[model samples]
Target: MADVHKVVFYPVGNGDTTQIVLSGGRRVLFDFCHRERAEDTDTPEIDLKSRFKDELKAVDRDYFDVVAFTHADLDHIQGSTDFFELQHAKKYQGEGRIKIRELWVPAAMLLEEADKDHQQEEFVLLRQEARHRLLEGKDILVFSKPKALADWLEPRLNERGEAASARDHLFIDAGTIVPGFSLASDGVEFFCHSPFIKHCDEGDIIRNRASLVFNVRFLADGAYYDYLEVGDATWEEMEDIVRTTRYHKNDDRLAWDLYNIPHHCSYLVLNEEGQKGDKETEPKPLVKELLLQGKRDAYIVSCSKPIPDIKESYEQVQPPHIQARNTYERYLKEVGGRKFLVTMEEPNANKPEPIVFEIASGGVTWKRSASIGAPAIITSTPPRAG
Candidate 1:
């Protein structure tokens, strides 16, 4: 039998939650967003807690191999504190909570400060948990080692009678492959693309600018594929990634077979200075180059609400912008891409389902919706060699 790997994007309505199920049955989850109301059963969004638990039970597991929080944004970390068993606090542990064998966080998540009003929020709590894991020097990968983070962490290490550089191996930087999984052994490898040290060194830490981005490369039967998991980075940051990556002569990291579009299809991701006009927003030069790197039969997925073409939606200030959607669709066509999918609008907006893709020797194919009543269908796109 052929090796089959699965990638799933859950419908969380203007949020992000994706899972990568490797052929070996190990699972890696990215940026969970479980709306509290989704548990009602009548809501359009999936009941993330119940669904994830059920999936784990079927496999006789209660932990994810790795759970990466791209950033501390509310949309990405919503209800995450309640879903996972946090090691930092006894109050958050137990209660049948799922465990995270490894936690991945950007350095900014460790250095950012919250005001008194926001101190008790989930982001703050998650930050505490990340700090605890890093201090323990195991079961965590903190991306980027900036001066600010080092300055803050060194003192704590000294207080604990450990060397200042004790946790250096725990830090991952841009333009490098993550340590754990390798394509040769695990059929997958992750290349860090954003959250550079400079991103943290330059004044205050902007969550979106400092969020995590990775080029996830998957191998199957001598064929290699790339999936880009981008956080809510803006056009300036994307341009920086493109420029820096090219300067390092690691341009292959920019190419992608599947792209998780950033910031819920916000126009800022296309043009740094905001929308160009009413009709469509042209991507900045480097952003355009990044989009054009999509391979044949590529896919761009937006984890946002349904983007209607009506006048009200066109003039809206917030995301799920029609103009940005138009820009993405135009460039997707230029690359001979397969589809531009919106999580909330797939198979009708009223009852959206998780969008899934299966990767094997046949390359990548979009499978049917995971929702009940949807056809058990799969696209017949031919495989392409890496």
Candidate 2:
């Protein structure tokens, strides 16, 4: 084998769950959406708990190198508390629960205040776990140290008889490559692109605005391929990222070979709020530029339900919107890109499998499954210059 890497996107139906297996055995999972109904075996959603456990068992492992929770949204963190062993509480430990060697979360996860009625939600529990690890000063990475987080953390550190800035190294900011992983050694480097300080520091905390976004660059035979794993960011945040990234001369971070489109292909990510007048939502000026940054034979993956071209679908309010999908397909065609894949519609909506992309020295290749009724298909894009 030629040191191939794998990126797997699950069919979570408008939710987000992506796993990146490095050329080495190390794995990093972004978001986790495990529906309870999936256990029935009849639901379209995969049984994430069973699949993840089986996958880890095949390798004789019990933990992930990095488990990043982009935001505390239900779709992103649903059923996560029951799946991963929480170091903060003994009740959540043991029983074959998967361990996270290093947990990654945005500052919002630490500072957000839960509503009284939703205080016991999974997001709150995950926040407690993240806070515990951060306080312990080990096995955790907190993205962006906004003032709100600092205010909360400084008092806690003071109570523990430690310097307020003691845990600064663990905090990663936007536009910088995450430490501990380098292309030279790990064949991958994550460049933080969003969840800037302002996003969290401003008056009220919006989960989507404070979500984590990264440009994951994979190195293979001296060539670099980018994967943009954006959370449920809206058009305002997208524009901010474009303006700030370009202003700082970090334009290359905008380029992507594999783009996980934001908000389950929601038009709000491409157009301004209340601007869906056109049947096909046109991408905002900066967003269009970002789409154009897709490299040759690039792919845009939508981690959402099937986007049908039916009459009722056009007027659908929620995500997996047909209009947004149309815009993405248009841009993919304009750029001569490879495919626009939907998680729940890959092979078929009834029993969709994970969309796997293998990265090798040659280039990226889509690994298609040949189920009984599904077509046997395998597509590989040509290698690009480093």
Candidate 3:
């Protein structure tokens, strides 16, 4: 058995972000979310300045190895802006801020073709800083289409400013692997999976399909540990990856120890169903198939509210954004293997703090810093919620 590795999934705003601490003691951040919610309700407040400083303090000196932005959604990219500001203002009351060793983003994210307004300016700044660091000979790995997309997006940004090509961003194809840490060194490796070449159409939906999905793997205790974070990608995107990669059904290569369910376990990402209603009569077979294939040890959904009911009015649904909760509960039971973790179940006044899992010779064990009281099920439909 090898030493242990720790992964922390932080409960940020209404989204998902996790921190990966390797056995070698290197720290990596998967995604960072917005500081506030849309309705301006009181959730746990994330003090960016203090939190950033605290994150550095928690780890060893200047030891944050990598910061990965899964995609360009506001919730994910907003923190980078705050991070850049904090990093730039080196002197914090005469102390030094943590030095970022490297920044890894998808190649498509750095594209010049995107309309400036469509993409956040902070992302542009972060990309620029990374480029500057690279010019100074710092290691920057642009996984999946870094070269090709950088070639396309950089010039466009330079010519039109960040907002000009906001909507015209570059997209990376699925199944591209970005080589990084090896299990031998207790490092992390990403197996790229989605957003094959950008343009996917499902009507009025945000370009979440453009998200770069990846399976992060590392070895611990002589056993392989796999964590799959498939950003808010939809059914179309998932199908695309499976088909394009020729990912064999039930292949162990696709198996995972943990999975962050796409779009917070919304049925839209699993079935043809959208906000209109669930089209699935029985469980979506693919949902079960993926679970079986992945051999998921656990599932995590980062959502603000319970899954919306298909029968209710769009307004009545807590989030009204995605489909009913019953769909997931039903599907989970059918798939049956791992435990399910949802952020909304936390009892804390603030959003539940991150959930940390340690992987060691004995297997994985998790603990929570925040007081998430108990798990409760709030269905989207009336009969279930009450």
Candidate 4:
């Protein structure tokens, strides 16, 4: 087949680290949360950073073309500075770490006066890197510039006498397309959908509300494969996205072959009351209707611990909630789907393998090389993950 293009979802516990290897070895990482060695018995003992390096070699690429941070959550941005080569660009190079040629971040991450009460060290570093890259005129696309932030920058631009287009190439608005990649050749196209002005203009930083949700599409033989990944988005935001996209006749962007279940399968994406005293909460009608749009053979993969049927207190409710998984399961049933992969669970082994979703002419399928593990569903070298 043509050179393989795939998306590998690492088995990080309740966190995300998805690597999208487009055709021609162009790499785009969604988020990063690496395991140092081995934390628990449920996950494999493979070093995630090392595994990524080996995969990069297979594609014969030395740097990540893009690294998109959905939001500044510790779970999403953790271990990023140590893993990727950030500042080793535009200067001396000796092969130290994976260089990030381009960065995609929401405006909240770059807000100069952001509320630091909840900032994580990794997130702080990531934000600083984005800021530095923008100042250097690098390929840094600020995902969504709310009117507040945009207004906040107008004076600075006037003072510096910088033309509107002087930085328009780097600053982006929501619902607009992101550049620096193509679909026909790169095998992928990204459409921005989040960091709404309302989300950013709030008094307190609602971190999750500022996430950069995208209708990430992969093209193959003129056909498009869609995957929706929203980091920690609540049901309110999810509903608005569905209604807005459909209202604007952007339904084509919502179709998906494989869905990376958002918020680690949390019910917050379904409704505010994810659980009610050990009993799962019911999803709203619109949320249910939206999920019914899944394509045939669609799969929902949750990258978290086992979605337990029991409930926990709201104060300590970890994501990948069993109730939410049940919701996705029912939706899959509607679409004649039979697979719902959990990252921490093995196909039939002591550890979990990187769930690989390969995009080919026929359709999407999951395959595992002999090194990492085996696929419980279809097999065909979907994409090997250690």
Q: Assess each prediction's global lDDT (C-alpha) against the native.
A: 0.90, 0.89, 0.55, 0.72
lDDT of 2 by residue, 197-228 (tens): 99887789899999999999998777888899
Q: lDDT tens string, model 1, 1-386? A: 57777888889999999999999888999999999889888888889888889788878999999999999999999999999999998999999999999999999999888899988899999999999999999999999999998998999999999999899999998999999999877899999998999888999899999999999999988889999999999999999999999999999999998999999999999996655568889899999999999998888999999998899988888898999998999999999888899998877788887888888887878886564223547754554644
Q: Candidate 1 at residue 106, lDDT?
A: 92
lDDT of 3 by residue, 1-386 (tens): 45767776655545656777777777777677656442244556444435545666655455467777777676677655644423323432124544456666655455533476744476566656555543333456554443455455456566655553342322223564464567666546767776554442322224476676777776765666677777777777766665655554424446666667766555566666533354332334554455555443444444444333444434342332444344554455555434556555444534545565666654455555532222323221111000
- Give the top-scoring candidate (TM-score): 1
Query: What are the runs in model 4 whose C-alpha is more than 4 Å off?
Result: 1-3, 37-46, 88-95, 112-120, 151-161, 274-280, 308-316, 370-386
A best-first ranking of the candidates according to their TM-score comes to 1, 2, 4, 3
Estimate the overall C-alpha local distance difference test score of candidate 3.
Answer: 0.55
Which candidate achieves the best lDDT against the true structure?
1
Evaluation by TM-score, superior candidate among 1 and 4: 1
User: What is the clash count of model 4?
Assistant: 2
Query: Cα RMSD (Å) between model 3 and the true structure?
Result: 8.1
Full-model lDDT, candidate 4: 0.72
lDDT of 2: 0.89
**In candidate 4, what residue range of length 10 has the lowest lDDT sum?**
377-386
Residue-level error in angstroms, candidate 4, position 155: 4.7
